[model samples]
Target: MTTSSNSPPLTPWGAAIITGVLLFLGYVGFDQFYLEWIFLLPLLWAIRDVRPRRAFLLGWVAGIVGHGGGFYWIIQMFQQFAGAPLPVGIVGLVLLAAANGVVLAVWAWGVSLLTRGRERHLVWIAPVLWTAIEKVWPEVFPNYLGASQYKVPHLTQIADFTGVLGVSFLVVYINATLYRILACRFEGKGVPWRAAAALGVTLVLVVAYGEFRIREVDGKVAAAQHLTVGLVQTNRGAADLHLSAGAIQQEHRDMSKALLAAKKADLVVWPEGVLSLGLPSREGTIPTWALGDLKVPLLFGACLQLNEEGETRFYNSALLADASGKILGTYDKTVLVPFGEYIPFGDVFPVLYAWSPYSSKFFSGKSVEPLKLGPHLLSVSICYEDIFPTHIRKLMRGGSEGRTPAVMFNLTNDSWYGNSTEPMEHLALASFRSIENRRSLVRVTNTGISAFVDPAGRITSRTGVWTREVLVDRVPLLEGTTVYGAFGDWIGWLCAVISLGAITLVTVSNRRDLTGKQNAL
Candidate 1:
């Protein structure tokens, strides 16, 4: 009789462990196809029997599996492409997976603390806290959650103002609602049928609103002015191009001819460092002969030297020029890629800089501001900067002080990843930004996925990867900002504050109940 009683108590615990493992595996499987929605259901299942410590542990496991599966290609890049040994490459992959896992662990712990013992009500705390953590943790892993939501155009419209955190908030809320229903059932109580119904209604309302917004934008695009853009995709490997100065110039000339054919184009874009040499200053590294032949407002990626005080600083920069080849403006990439551009804490640990062949001290741009191009105000994002939704939001807000920009320009070199799903993933992210900001996005990538995306996140036209080709497309110059653009990350911040407050209140209440029971004893 005692053994039977003990077995009944252990049943839920065993079920919980099995459920968590299944959920982790589910997340990994879904990530293979980049179908993020599948993991949401399993995540809800795992959180149903949420003990604080168990929640944290389970979340960490899910995160490791999910990220390790999705970004396993990083291992291939390190070992095969970058030529790191097998063991070192594996260790690098593990470290990146662990770092990503930490974010989910923190999120799970926060949710557990907020919802502890209150397995009764449909607590709205988890979603808000999860969104808050998703927004802030990007300071560490800048290219994670928001970038993953690129394929969901209907949901990504919220990113213009709130950035990707807004989409994350909705996704988490839906999962939380699902968890609430399961928890109610587990406790052998009548299903909190009202809460479940409310959640369903809320989702419908949000989707309807998004559909309406998309329709409205579609109608406006038909009447809007269109700009012809020339995008250049140079299929050159970074390592192989370091051969000769003359060979590099010939490559740039060939790539430029592809763009020059699109004479009707208002803007011409080149991928990052298409010109292997640095930009010409007043002192002039590029001769007067090279400057005279340029046509159209050419935006090309190159390295540039900035003289500040007595120091000469080198920057990964985008140069803007007119038809006559006169330089107009230059935007340096502010958010530098760690290890790729410059080593982190290289001054303290110089040995770490020896890991990569690139410069150990590449400089970062000071501002996230937009550049002025003819009648249009343009926001220029270099390479991976397009993946960070918040940084893009700040750039848009800064540019739209009086009027919003006609379009957003992204200059990138995805050649490092070669012909892989990484480029497709990168394109998906750029498309989300286009829908979010209600602005046309023109992405010029080296070695493929060069395309134009409308404000509705539609890929109007694109070129093949690893192909040396020019893509010319007309994109609508959209007006009107999104709700997410206007508010910034206030929604995420509010959720975090409320979740923390709720946790504090619950902790206090639990302590009081414990005191009362002790006194009674």
Candidate 2:
């Protein structure tokens, strides 16, 4: 059971499988969710008294199972949209899961050191390290464990100040504390009062803060001037594989027109990549569409191809068109989705990807700018770009004119995910941005879950999956910056620093102890 053992107890395969399955059940990943506190208990138990390498392998297996299970929706997406073979899509899913497992392997080794040896006192550092690891998790596949708790509003409001890292830390802290208590019990220790008491107080403050935040945001939202925005979900996505670009554009235009029959909206939004033809969309031009007959400004996604220095570059752009059919501004998505948009390291290692999808690259946007929508300015995120908190903060910070947007819009096309759980999961992760910035957020998707989220991170209006509907609602736009809105990624950075300090402390202590033991001998 010594921490310096080169070989220790081997973890059974059953333990790893159980740990991963439990972790998967705790994710927004599934149709039903289980208690997150119990998710990591098995892994901690499996790794106890085991060598660091064995612990790492166990954790890696758990991660592979959990990640692959939670993100299985990706397989359906690839087959539906990318025209990928069933076997190829499955392989893609496994590859992604294995890639993410590396992070868990390191975490497993760190946890072994933290929960064992003379440095076991650093077990309390678990939450900090967990948050830092989440921040390190691939931005392309953003399924942070904290997102699963979005349904629990009381625990979610803490995201306002610390961003999602705070909620993630809290959840991980509970898991760590519970694991510690169980480990101590096995060792004949009654209880870890110091760590337990600290965790108890932290939970108390988290709940208390959530209540105060809810009350404060309610008052501000009630008194604030509301903007009426219409979200159009045309139910036209790449999944169908039959709808031509022109047909998709027509469906969106028809839906928007039908929605106007109810009441005029200040601004109308479309899902990303909905605009194909019937408008001057391709060839880097915005021609007049049937939407020109309407008296409201339109914001929608388009595929823009332009020639730069005799070289052609394509972009996934969200363009604004006035009622007069004049082009206003186009916000090209700066943060593109990996694999889905472009392959990572495709330029450096060309031979790595012979896949056709990886061959085409969409040029990244240099800047993120807010588009004008009637009297209020709107910050837009195309596709998966909305999930990045750092990028959303830049919008709140405003452009060179310092003209901050009162509303934020996320244009996404999730139909490729099919009837899977991703639409809701994606929505949950994006909701944190609303609270972080204290701005009204709207998601206009190609298929379903089109919603309007208030500054409190509450979903005021939402549509069912695969529904073709237009959501017309009043969005409460709160002014002024929030604590997290002003300080971007500070919490994640702080957790990273804490993790490094913990590692150093444990490593140095272990080294000194070995030296002292040798001298005594």
TM-score winner among the candidates? 2
Which tens-of-lDDT digit does each residue in 1-521 have in candidate 1? 11112345544334334433433333322333233433444444454445667667766766666566656666655754446777877887778877877667777776666655564443476667777676666543344354555555666666665666676676666666766676567657767888788877876876776788788888999999888888767666665445553565566666566566646678778777655344335233343235324456778787777676677778888877776666677788888876667778886988876765554367888766567777777888888888776778777875436566678998887776656666777787667778668888889876788898888777788988888788888878766787767776787788777766877888898899999999999
Per-residue lDDT for 415-512 in model 2, tens only? 87988888988888898898888888899888888998887788888998988888999887667888898777787888888888878887899899
Strongest candidate by lDDT: 2
Any residue pairs clashing in model 1, and if so which?
160-485, 161-484, 161-485, 162-484, 296-323
What's the CA error at residue 440 for candidate 2, in Å? Answer: 1.8
User: Residue 171 of model 2: what lDDT?
Assistant: 82
**Each prediction's whole-model lDDT (CA):** 0.67, 0.77
